[model samples]
Target: MKEQPNLRDATYQEEAAIDSNSTSIAGLVRQLTREVPSLFTKELALAKAEITEALNTTKAATIGMASGGIVLLGGFIMLLLSAVLGLSNVVAPWLAALIVGGVVCVVGMIMVSAGKKKLDPAAFKPERTINSMQKDKEAVKGKVA
Candidate 1:
């Protein structure tokens, strides 16, 4: 399958030829002013696209973790039961079972929480677009200076 082009990494390439249209510095400024926002809009769209793709991937992983955690709990229940039975000799049966179940539930919840953290939108900040925009800003400032 062919890979889709990443618009965020695109650069404008132009020949150093004079335009037949208005060549005044004001004209250039006008064009830049018009194009800058368009470029930024495109960049932002690209960032959103990238984040969406990452979200799909992270979603799968998060789902896997959550499901695994659930399955682990099912299996852990059996193990805890055995543990409770063994501990019953030392402690009360009900107390032992409660303690074991509580500990296992906490561990399972922690795994689910870790998965939730991975799915956080904040975690998917568009690094490439941010860096590109920063460079663009610096270059524009340098030109103005």
Candidate 2:
């Protein structure tokens, strides 16, 4: 007669097979679903904060774009108005053109000045970063020495 397999060993092998076979893709997904809600909540919160920050900054970006557009549109309209008025013949066309040109130039200069004022070089952090790097290099050299 053929020798029979040991009951305990056979049971252990069956249990291992069950363990391996039970962990299917669906089972893994269910496990992840059970554990991921907290992680999802944290990520969702982070995303919301980032979105809020972007939303807050959007107004400033929009205002900047609108202001630039308005400046361009205003210059265009002024030029058109000047041309129309000059053609209507109350003043000499050349004189009107000169006056309009001067006005436009003045407005452009004012806008440029305003833009320069708004652009603060001090706000950039490059100098601070350079200083920190210089300090770090000195420290590293001292350590090597």
Q: Which candidate leads in TM-score?
A: 1
Candidate 1 runs further than 4 Å off:
1-24, 105-121
RMSD of each: 9.3, 16.0
Model 1, 71-115: lDDT tens digits are 987997788778999989999999888888888789879977986
Residue pairs with clashing backbones, model 2:
none
What TM-score number comes out for model 2?
Answer: 0.36
Compare the candidates by lDDT and give the number of the best one.
Answer: 1
Off by over 4 Å in 2: 1-63, 66-88, 126-145
Model 1: lDDT of residue 25:
67
Write candidate 2's Cα lDDT for 50-140 as tens digits: 5566566666876997898989898898767867586658777777777777877898899889977755645333444455556655754
Positional deviation of 136 in candidate 2, in angstroms? 15
